[model samples]
Target: MLSGLQRDSFEYSIHNANPVNGLVRDKSRDGWPASIAAVGLALAAYPIGVERGLMTRDDAVKRTLTTLRFFATAPHGPEPDATGYKGFYYHFLDMHPGRRAWRCELSSVDTALLLAGMLAAAAWLRYDTADENEIRKLADALYRRTDWQWMQHGEATVSHGWTPEKGFLLYRWCGYDEALILYLLGLGSPTYPLPAESYRAWASTYRWKKIYGIEFLYAGPLFIHQLSHLWVDFRGIHDEFMRQHDLDYFENSRRATFVQQQYAIRNPREFEHYDELCWGITASDRPGPRTLLVDGIQRAFHDYIARGVPFVRRLQTKKEPTWRGGRGLTSR
Candidate 1:
């Protein structure tokens, strides 16, 4: 099933990629704009396509080149319809022209995801061909051009995103979530690196909770525990917070996964079909915006939400200062 899904996902990119440019649509639905993060994932998937014998090396290289070239040359200004501004691309863009779409903010995390894909592609296709060399150069240019410090918005932590209409978003990236890749990318940049202290500032926002008697860094969504590790290896890495707790993120994620299963087994919420064999919830689509009375309880559901095992009292042994702002504590 996993392999089938993998092949399907790679095929989705191939089907959705704009032939004129390489931008992939965020969703398969009609009239949806391109998601930079989805583009990033698509960029990262090409090499896998080659390795899996789903695509030829030439084809993968050709596809990657198209994406890198377009972003490198695309108009990047404060204009309402530019591809990006200050090296950070908007969250959504037009499929053909690659202009900003849907009034989306210049997303720091999404751009980081895109850079991650660019760098990954550059690293994998390391042949001495001209196309491969240009890929490396363009990837570095996009990474360096990002003004990580400017995104701070005069604060220690990075802002969630920026809007041309209103400047920076009021909320900032804090605590631990999918932005783990975002912060690391900034910190690792050679030209516009975020300060080392910024990592500390971000780490300080972590919450240590003993969920199911397993103490680990507390973040509700399972994806939050996995996304960074997907692109960046953290198996043996120990950051400041990890050093303090004597636990690396990789190990913490493992614990979090176990806790997720345990949460399902316990079934505190009494969700039907939640058990040891059936569990694991992350952000997903929901048919909601309506209220229903279930088991004599009136509950409201929303269209889309990031779901996780509820953080219960049994999970807390002490208080940990959390720095996550902007998005709600759990269901963003």
Candidate 2:
């Protein structure tokens, strides 16, 4: 059986297949731009392929490397085979770059995710010539400067890039987890371990309001999964860390994004775009769109992800702090 990551990747590929251009379309309205999500998913699919005995690690890595090359070379937006849009930093829709200047610096979270997928792909490919050191160097660079404050469970970067607020849960799934883990462990540095309190500072200071946002659901897993891994190695510290932060799984967040996926499968057109889905989820589907759950539990997951959207949106959009706000304590 394929790992969930691999299966999701294949499904994503299917959803992304577009004929107008020989490239996978990004998942956004006028979603002509490509993004880290597709790259991350593609990178994740490889190890998953190996785990299921579907492909050798070497083969999968090779394929992923080829794909990466394509992504690097492809024409993003209207530019023909150009450096293309950088999405959050510099995105182009329908062959046109956004009007705003490319101001957002390279985000550590995004870079970490791109590297994680790349490292995993390299491992699978067993490219004897693979520059593992280079990978480590880049990964290290991302982790060292990562802004933990931006990763609070319920909030995210505002459009202007200040005042961290509750964010969509799904974006967390992309790369936040890996980045967090790296920061926590101090693995981003040449030094392997650091004072545990550094991690604690982050856990303590993070803030958010509880509401089911799409990012919270679809992307949040990456953070949760990675944190779980850290907890396994340092449970005593992690347990304390969790306690300090007053964190628990918002199971509904995942459920909400899953529902949006189901909705997309059922209504692939612009039927109920904004009301139904958020910026990220809607941008993911590809040509001749149709919704179908490949996984048996997809329905359950859909309900779970779907339900959280309103609650999260309520929290993010609301000016007043909600019951879910703060760290180490609930607002209520």
Q: Pick the lDDT winner.
A: 1
Per-residue lDDT over 42-138 for candidate 1, one digit per residue giving the tens place of the 0 to 100 score: 9898999999999999999999999999999999998888999888999999887899888889999989889999999999989999999999999
For each candidate in turn, the TM-score is 0.89, 0.43
For candidate 1, give the lDDT. 0.83
For candidate 2, the 10 contiguous residues with the lowest summed lDDT are 157-166
Candidate 1: regions farther than 4 A off: 293-298, 311-332
- Give a tens-digit lDDT track for model 2, residues 209-317: 3322322312232234342242224333433534544433334233434544543544433333544343324211133233455433222123223322222212322
Residue pairs clashing in model 1 are: 174-324, 175-324
Give the range where candidate 1 is weakest over 10 consecutive residues by summed lDDT.
Answer: 314-323
Clash count list over all predictions: 2, 43
| Candidate 1 C-alpha RMSD relative to the actual structure | 4.0
